[model samples]
Target chain A: MTDINFKKIIRIGLIVYFAAIALFTVGTLSRLKDGSVFGLPKFLVYGAVVLVLTVCVLLYVLHLQKRLKSGKDAFGLRVLRTIHKYRFLIEQLVTRDFKIKYKRSVLGVFWSFLNPLLMMIVQYVVFSYLLNFRGTVEHYALYLLCGIVIWNGFNDCSTQSMRSIIGNAHLITKVYVPKYIYPVTKVLSASINVLLSMVPLLLVTVIYGLIATPKLYLSFAVLLLPLALLLLLVFCIGIGFILSSLMVFFHDIEFLWTVFSTIWMYATPIIYSLEMFESRAPWLITVMQFNPMYHYINFVRSIVLYRTAPTFLEMGITALISFGTFAVGLLIFKKCQDKFVLYL
Target chain B: MNEERKLMISVQDVTMTFRREEDRSGSLKETVTKLLSRKLKFSTFTALHDVSFDVYNGDVLGIIGRNGAGKSTILKIISGIMKPTKGNIIRNGNIVPMLELGSGFDFDLSGRENIFLNGAILGYEKPYLFSKYEEIVDFSELRDFIDVPLRNYSSGMIMRLAFSIAAVVEPEILIVDEILAVGDENFQKKSRARMMELMGGGTTVLFVSHDMNQIREMCNRVIWLDGGTIRMQGETKEVCDAYRI
Candidate 1:
């Protein structure tokens, strides 16, 4: 029974991936060299905006990383040992998340696709009519779709990862697992959801006559997007490990996080294209250049919009920053994890 | 001390304390004051203090304690679920703790799925558990409902299933924490027999319970804990008698 379900879920994941690829191809081809794609030639002002956003994100990551490192085993191999020690518990929570989240829901996981699709339509209507925005309908729709889907992955991962450790306070206090695995699972679940949301992106692209292209298959670089998101997720998890552990003793983080997520949403280039400020904003673009999330979004845009591989420079920078932040985050989270039981 | 009886578990000079908060008022000023004072103003209640004991392989060491006596805390420490505030515990075997059967089981999952899950929680690998699947189902007598989700199971059914899984998987050291009280008479008989089989083998069993009769019947040696201290440690009947008063 378990094997059957596992296979079924994997099949669903594959189908979603395939569908996303086809959709991205069609969408990119249709919008290629068309005057409709917000027509910003290397949006300089937008770079400035993303640069500022990047600096803030980097500062936040560094601040939290410092706080976590101030405790024991600053490198945090001890926490990794703890995770290996309680691998079973992590597996249990993963299965629990699967069962509890999907119980009695008819759409089951199809809601993953349905959710982003519905959001796309609603946003299209609101932006097209309420704001009186005038971009090509297809461009606006596809841009919003791509951004929203990618943001959904990020939002779901970070938001869930923030609560991942705390939400399982019962397990955290009672059972010992690597404190990072819970947050990792939260990120993975959101990643899966993001992957599923690609289905709608595909269906919409097909409607616009953007079918298969050599660039479409090359979209496999999108898989690398998770690696970057994972770094962010790790950064969040590490921060979560310290914050949530502290939150157990002092209970204000939940409320603080709700507001932080809102600010974080605007901080990322999800709602608007990074091209919007390219020519006008210099300092902002410089700051945005440092924003890892900007790179994360651009990573997606490179695959879906630009129809080419992400430049080695972008990939190299993202890889270095992401893995570094991820390692630091893990170290911090592990250093502070043992303090949780004492605080509780 | 019998030198020939090698110690499988040693609880030496263990002390556990918990802080009792005095106020429930919600005030930033109060919190700030507490922070400024750099003192939590907590009155420490010792849950276990200077407690020492040892058990050998194949010994069923029952712990008899009154309601506030820290029996379960001892189990928790031994199980590695909770850390001791001080002292050290050296356990020399694979400890399969039935701290709370079904504690981690997701109610939405089917009985079969939960068995594998709960088995893993108790430290059994998936393939090993799958091999013993038929035996577990047969022992629990829940074959017909194996595929049904656990939330639908009655308390007896839950206990039966949980007990069966724990008992079926033979561990080097088994700590049973007051699970017998919930089982029906038939299950009680089955569990008792299973416990006897485990004790008769090389598995060291640390049984914690309030039932004196069960302790007297099952344990060769007993320790009675009172208010975080062991008041008596000796033969099971002697300790039980001391605990009764």
Candidate 2:
């Protein structure tokens, strides 16, 4: 990377970190009014702030990395030809994944939906009925379903993409296609599963009459769900690029993600409500607001539950964060792509 | 038709190096230190050194060499699979390199699908491949197993299918590595006949192999590479005679 580009990314990283911290501090103080110092509210706020800052730093590092490597981009006529060639390659790989994964299986693709439904059943059985959870059963199911499904999408896409390049290390070394195409293909493949999982969630919403708010017809938030998902996919793309590249040098990244994701699942308010800690833990809610994925999930939840879209500010932050994540992912993937050949 | 013709491929001053440990003996402590020290014992082995050659269109040039003589490296360099440490490869037409047989198959994909997939990798668009699909399947004699996943195919069956697809996708220049060695003798004979047909259709072929008899029988010109440099470039008999030693 040139000194100028490196400096630009560093400046952006520092600004985001400081901005997130400032917002968390204000949000934390706002929550502190109703509770004692060092209470649950304060911990939640600080925890959420840390999550947002960590994501920002990770993304900026990926961005700086991609900018440093110079050989990846195809310059002139080669670009068009490469696109033409690799498009088929990516398509074929996706088809291979699809065909190979469910080959000779009964229920084939229905299992995509079945897997998430089974998880929902477990959650419903445990939290809603068995434990007699404090929240309303239907509302809890709706909330948990929304968060778990989206989180699964992000988790599956990132983990699969991180391994996509390494798993296809044979092809990457022998063939000349740009390396990013592998992870991009994995994202596309997992998207098929993600789309499948959404069906059950949508059905539950309609059947339960949970989406009854008139503002739900505002259509902007509804329209923004797909847009938001696209951004999130781009966000995963960026994360996938960084993790896959890092996994080459440190084989531990794949294992680390397994543990990290399990912990992250609890950090987001999947089983619990933001309200549980809002008055008692306002700072936590403010900090979670900074997490792009958290914001995305809540944005979807808001449209479904509250019937109104995220405020212009929330939508703006989501867009900016998603775009920045994608840019950085591309940079990291491009930087480490060449080193792959040597390591192999 | 005569001796004077347009050159199709040019290779200049190419070199490749591989590192190996040095043969230095010492006391146990000294040996251990020498192995781990910053100034470690090592040696540089050059696979190819200052190699240069050119082959013209309509010239069936065979590269003859010993096992470690950089023959494969030269072929890989011209095919754009491997970059040379210090040289340039200027080619005039599309190059199709058959470095290894059935290397591109995704075991999950069927034989028919892999034909399309391999064709795409070799630069064939979908429509053209679809049109030529029947011919490839027929030539491979793999019609019965066409829809079966490649993982189930025997080695010979896979080679036949892979070679058939590549043969049908006739590029302007064909570079065949020693894939013919592994297939059955019948398939080898079939491959020779198919190569003859490809050459008859005006494709330039640079066939690389260690077999001197095949080189003499197949190529009009032969370039013997030894220690990464061209030892001789002349008529097949002349070069193969020198390479036979």
Candidate 3:
């Protein structure tokens, strides 16, 4: 009876999966006629490779179904189980981080909204007034705000998570909670601030839209802002895992990260436009393209500043980078976690 | 004792070694310089050496040793806080390790918030904590001050709160390390009674304490550690008698 049910489920799942793939292929083909499918050939190749890889994975899972049921779980399943078991712990820790951060502050949670605005203003003055980037980008305030919000989320998440394991030494030495919970929760709490800061970004966009000449209309593309932020959050969590694990062994990572993030902030086209770098050093733009933050910030900019839907290629790149980093970070974290107690 | 009793935990040949650096390097630069100058040196210290033991169902096992004799290390290994360098431990049930009470509590959080946070850290689900919330507060006698931040809490009050939250949970295996003394005289008596109640309720326990009297009173089995190795293992009375001499 269970065998039949499993076969039936797999059949339905494959049908749905193939149907979605067919629909996407047709959409890509339609876009191809208009010559608007960005790098169509490459996109199709990646799509085909992804399809084949997923099919192979499905087959492998089916082959291992018997072993999976007998007691030993797959790695991903074990991770999910661990996550499910400790979800409330994660929630409590995140709450603790939020409370502790704003405990003594008079402003309290309002700072999450105000922090990005203040940062945008500081950068706007430095770049626009001093560097004469005032007229460079349309809706420059919104542009700066968008970049700052995403960059700050990444910065805060990575920096705070890097310290999470060491910071929670009192707990680590005494308990058996999964070590990964620390970095994961830090990313989650930091993302809360990122989420709050988006309100100001939207407000600026609307206020600027009312005052601008060609009235910047709020596009349906604005709906994709959350998707972009989710991708950024995933990327941050991955980086958090890698950094926190490393920080346990090497105390120097903290100082190194300070210098690293500052350099990283400059590499990302936040205050300065990519056009500025394109003119003087064309090669820098290529290097910037490789930077995951560049893709993430650009993804946000495409939605809010450009007022357009991100192309599938852009979405694909962000997903790849985010999940790829996540995979690597998880691997490093899992490998090092058992040794953390010794180092701590 | 029944020979057919089930094993709650079986620890086999566990060994833990710590490599201590003569001059600890906290940075890459220092490490690189030490490597270049041939000054990097390390000394090995074994915290546990080929330790093996079994905890039967509902057996209250006590571990006693002087400082650096591996009592805490063994407890930590069994509680799953630290991985053993060599050996395996098979645990049959959930562990609530009260190695240090209120270790996961945040001082900035309110007394009420710390209860949920500490409970969660000890692996209690939200609904469980919610049901026990009022009871924990009542037991801690901190209902009036539940909303107050823990930073303002006196050390005894914090210990009372920690013990109350910990005591309410019914764990399959309870691993505690030298934290029995808590709060004032009245509260300590209450906490000791609570501990006895949990022990009497047939929960397997691994306890580490310096007080031989406490071990003799509480534990059915005892393992006396000496210099990272098990020097003796037998009935609590037998082992405690030997250690006292």
> Highest DockQ, which number?
3
Q: Using DockQ as the measure, what is the rank order of every candidate, best first?
A: 3, 1, 2
Q: How big is the positional error of residue A336 in model 2, measured in Å on the Cα after superposition?
A: 2.8
Native-to-model Cα distance after best TM-score fit, residue A195 in candidate 3, in Å: 1.0
**Of candidates 3 and 2, the better by lDDT:** 3
- Give the lDDT of residue A172 in candidate 1: 53
**Residue pairs of candidate 2 with colliding backbone atoms:** A1-A68, A41-A281, A44-A284, A45-A283, A45-A284, A66-A331, B48-B228
Which residue window of length 10 is worst by lDDT in model 2 chain A? A212-221
- Quantify all predictions' global Cα lDDT against the true fold: 0.69, 0.73, 0.86
The C-alpha local distance difference test score for the whole of candidate 1 amounts to: 0.69
Counting clashing residue pairs in each candidate, in order, gives 25, 7, 0
TM-score of each: 0.76, 0.75, 0.89
Candidate 1, residues B1-245, lDDT tens digits: the string is 34587678999999999766666323445677876987656677899999998888778899887898998888878877677889999988778776666655777899998887778766676667889999999989999999999889998999888888888767788888764534788778888787667766767889888777778878889998889998989988777776677
Instruction: Indicate the DockQ of the complex predicted as candidate 2.
Output: 0.18
Runs of candidate 3 exceeding 4 Å displacement = A1-33, A36-72
Question: Relative to the unseen true structure, what is the C-alpha lDDT of residue B117 in candidate 1, on a scale of 0 to 100?
Answer: 74
Off by over 4 Å in 2: A1-81, A129-138, A210-220, A279-281, A286-290, B1-12, B17-46, B50-52, B84-92, B179-186, B232-235
Comparing candidate 1 with candidate 2, which one achieves the higher DockQ? 1
Candidate 1 local Cα displacement, residue A7, angstroms? 26
| Candidate 1 vs candidate 2, TM-score winner | 1
